[model samples]
Target: MKKLLAMLLVICSTASAEIQPEPIGRIQTLPDPYPPHWIVAVDVAFFHMNDGKLIVLDADSDDPAGRFKGMMNGTFIPVMYMAETRPEIYVLESFRARGHRGERTDVMTIYDKTTLAPIDEVVIPAKRVSAMPTEYYLQLVDDEKLALIYNFTPATTVSVVDLEKREFLGEVPIPGCSLIYPLAGRAFASLCGDGKLLTIQLDRNGKLVSSERTEAFFDADNDPLMEKPAIIDGIAYFPTFLGNVFPVDLSGSAPVIGESWSLVEGVEGGWRPGGIVLAQGDASGRLYVLMHPDGHDGTHKDPGSEVWVFDPQTKQRVDRIELALPAITMGLTNDDDPLLVTTNINLEVDVYNANSGEHLRTIGNFGQETVFLFHSDR
Candidate 1:
């Protein structure tokens, strides 16, 4: 019996060694510029902040394995931005020499879009915001020639770097404002604490040329607008805590504040916009907002159960998409036919047809926390 068992085991091991994978040392690469329908979901990994990840999924495919493009590391609550002209992905991240307790170093790591590998890194200030990552934090302005990194050490300031020269230019102090809103030519704006927009203009050398603030646009104490906005063709559509859209035209040197409109007129259930990513826009110039029922104080950060679609031109609710699951974060691709990407209540990623308002499928949870979604061709 022992001899027979030995013989069987030897035969099984010999057979397994005979069949080997055919491909030998072949590396796979993604397209130079990713498809416009691709979605990049950023996971902050609250359980373990040191191991953050940025997952890329193909929204056009329903297959679990087939739609997964690839992923890259987003160490330490990194903020991401996709480059339009270059085939590069920029991540503003921080590192500690002792794995969480040493001299902290922050850098702008430039990754190759094709290989999904870090190609170069430009060192910046160590004061990058360590809180929740948002779309307006690290913005590329000045025709994508300059990169602005938002910093907060209990005080607000912006660090400007010349991406073309790969050098840190200087820091601009924005003491009372928050978030970066790119303006026309060498300028950007931020929302002030007093319900106003402060515009900052810079020169070719990245030095501050002028700064101005608009009159109180909205009542900050009573009704505050969500800093996140859907920017379409240089117009920012920002939603208030209640359900109103405030349009700001950023096509000129200074921001032109347009009239505000209500989105929940005649609608029921007390629907109001709320979520980490409150609003997004599709390629057809339509606005999509995450909404929840029975909204109240402190409910502004709650996950939304429905998505309200509206025509920016008409400012009317065209369609409302009932979410398959409550979503905490949301994003939309910039394609003609777009896919609504979101991180649901269970931390899972869900895809829906933007035009038809159909629940496509859920991609399952990729990490402990996915707070932001980035969309673009690159």
Candidate 2:
């Protein structure tokens, strides 16, 4: 009896030992250079603004495990720009002295793509805009050597940062203008409150060289253009509160405001372009705009039901893409053959064939409220 009891104990011990512990202190690294379809989804976390996030994932991957590559957290409302020439990701973010609020602090964090770890940080003015996420709020110019940050301390200004030196270049004041659009060589154009395009040029040393404003291009109070614009081949395609396309040719040293065209010229059901990130222009200069029905007052920021494609040469919509779900924001992956990515009302990232407009795959359980999508071909 004693021998049998001892043997039972030995058997139980052997079984317990076979269960291996999870590997500890293991670090995983993503692909050095990610695939073309990989996108960084921005989670502004509206309900919980301080704890924001930027999720990087493979838009084309079917498996969820394979799709999610990496992520980084933000202290406050933040905007990110992926560097083309450098292996770094720039995040213009803010922090509070305490947990939620105290003294405010803003900084541009330089993160390494491989480790997804913040490698460097540059202190900037604490007056960064604290509203919805927009790529225009933060832009990279001067061959990615200088980053322009749009500030709305109620007073509009652009904070220039020397990317190579990692220092804060002087802030250029544009009294009534906001948003930043990279224009011809070392220059940026901003949309003004009085319906003008303010172009601010920078010297080789990242200093203000010259600035000018074009005549009133669009009606600001009546039918304002969405701050979001699809800049393709040196031209920005801005969609108005209605369904008009306002093109600003940034190909030259100064902006040339082109003629406007109605997108819903012959359409019905009150169709209009609306959403957070509603516009996208591909390498071929084709415009992809998010559209919906039953447009009304204050519905300019509503989610979209379809994507209207347009031919720049003809200034006419060529194709209309019906979405599987209502999308709040949209973006395009920069591949030889691009893919249109959109965030549905449920915060699921939907992938579609840019050319065919076919629903490829939908990525659910991505993030809590993805407000923006970032993907680049270059």
Please list the Cα RMSD from the true structure of every candidate, rounded to 1 decimal place. Answer: 5.0, 4.2
lDDT of each: 0.87, 0.86
Q: Taking the tens digit of each residue's C-alpha lDDT, what string does model 1 give over 1-378?
A: 999999999999999889677987888789967877777778888778888888777877777777778888988987888888888889988999999899999999998888889998889889898987788998888789999888888699899988888888988999799889998888999999999999999998889999899999999988899999988888999999998889999888899999999989888888889998879988889999999999999898899999999999998889999999999989998888888988889888888998888998888744436556655573
Worst 10 residues of 1 by lDDT: 365-374
Q: Encode model 2's per-residue lDDT on 112-204: one tens digit a residue.
A: 887889999999999888788888888888678889999998999989899999999788998899999987678999999899999999986
Residue 296 displacement (Å), model 2: 2.3
lDDT of 1 at 176: 93
Global lDDT of model 1: 0.87
Candidate No. with top lDDT: 1
Q: For model 1, how many clashes?
A: 0
Per-model TM values vs. the true structure: 0.92, 0.91
At residue 369, give the lDDT of candidate 1.
68
